[model samples]
Target: MAKPTTEVALISVIVALFLVSTTFASSDAPFIVAHKKVSLNRLKSGAEKVSVSIDLYNQGTVTAYDVSLSDDSWTQDVFDLAGGNTSKSWERIDAGSLVSHSFVLESKVKTMFYGAPAVIKFRIPTKAALQEAYSTPMPPLDILADRPPEKKFEWAKMLLTKYGSLVSVISIVVLFVYLVATPSKSSALKGSKKRR
Candidate 1:
């Protein structure tokens, strides 16, 4: 009688685990992810330019609808829009799809600027509430002060870092060829001297 009761209890536990796994596996939803990148370029005219690029990816099983992206982090006095709009919208992004947006900001004044994350909003047909997400945040950027004159030593160091290995390889090959050729010439000279 005890063995029969233990078998019944084991069967009941197995049935419960199977039900829970199926319930979670049946859920299908759309998940949106955003990544933001910022680059600073120094121009020859003593102005700094900030380039911003944002990428949106849908990692969910279903398609996302009514997608929008907005970035209003820079102040009007600090940055001027050089090109491209800061806000964009799309009708939909399919499952496992990617979209990208970019803009450039030019700042003539030298100062430090703090940035905020870009906002992303989307909707699901089955859900009433609008889903919201934010792109990755960026740290503070220093647009402050004038860049000093470039030194020759600094330029040399940069060149060395870029082409030092290639130069070394060429030098080694040239040295090896010279050493091999000189040995044959010296051997011929020694043979002539012995004959004389």
Candidate 2:
């Protein structure tokens, strides 16, 4: 009786360990290794250039296939891929391997504020995986139109740039009007003496 009880306990322990190991193994499947960087570059024309770079690693023991990256807002007008179409693809990423992709996109500064999120999609023999990469808020562009003057000097510069000619013309007209309206002091004194 004692021997049978010991055997049963040993079997139960083995079964628990097996279950835990299988769960861990499944959880370690192919997934995004990391989001290396996402950044925005502001252009002088009040447009924004966006770049997203990411690394995809296969943590599982099997190769990943049909890997692609997508963003709903991505279009031919804005994104020009280095080689492929709207959805980037890789035939296969081997087990314990990493792949890097960089995307360059262009848009108006205002449009970037409503940009879409990026997603990684890949498939394995057993199933497909879709993961969302770490997204950074699109940085506001510092274009001349969007950024307000921070210093008094900047404000003065902006005003001069915008209204310099108008201001100068108005000043000239005011000076001419004053000169025509006011009689010379010498002329007024001469007339008064003549009258006396």
Candidate 3:
């Protein structure tokens, strides 16, 4: 009795987790998915220059911000560097995943990702930050979008996509099975042959 009830409750909780994620619940239903990317491996100190791209999709509006996207590393003295100097020290500029910088304007109501309205864009100023730090190794990026994490956590994304439908289907299946297995009034169905 209690066992079956507990099992059902557990399933219900799992279904709910599969439905809603950290946020961006339905993010415009198919647009508005933030994708914050970065790079580190092939970054040659002075071999070439600061070059990277950080593009976020699925935006509901458009805005801008003076976000620090490129370098997370900085020394105490680096803070005093002029914006222009900071730009040079960073040596790289690319987009990052931080919605905090997004600014909303009355004129900008909607944008799109691929086809949907993009809410905001993170134009990372890598070179700018590099210049600010000047020769110091840029700190690791802390501006990536807090979403679609590792392989295991990523499964949650797929589950949430068709959550409503999946939940309905699962519920229907469970109900159907219970009805078939549970007798109408007793442990056995009427007119059924008993096992000899």
Q: Candidate 3's error at 114, in angstroms?
A: 26
The lDDT per prediction is 0.84, 0.61, 0.32
Least accurate 10 contiguous residues by lDDT in model 1: 15-24
Q: What is the lDDT of candidate 2?
A: 0.61
Residues 139-170 of candidate 2: C-alpha lDDT, one tens digit per residue: 33332235544585887899999999999999
lDDT winner:
1
Candidate 3 per-residue lDDT, tens place, 32-129, comes to 23322323221123121222333332232222233233332223321222222211111222222233222211111111111111122123222232
Flag clash pairs in model 2: none
Models sorted by TM-score, best on top? 1, 2, 3
TM-score of each: 0.66, 0.45, 0.19
- Candidates 2 and 3 compared: the better one by TM-score is 2
Each model's total of backbone clashes = 0, 0, 33
- The list of candidate 1 runs beyond 4 A from truth reads 1-27, 144-196
- The sequence of per-residue lDDT tens digits that candidate 1 reaches over residues 1-196 is 4674466457645754664465367557777778889999998887898999999988777898999999998899989999999999999999999999999999888887768789999998999888887776665688845668778699789999999999999999999999887768778999999999
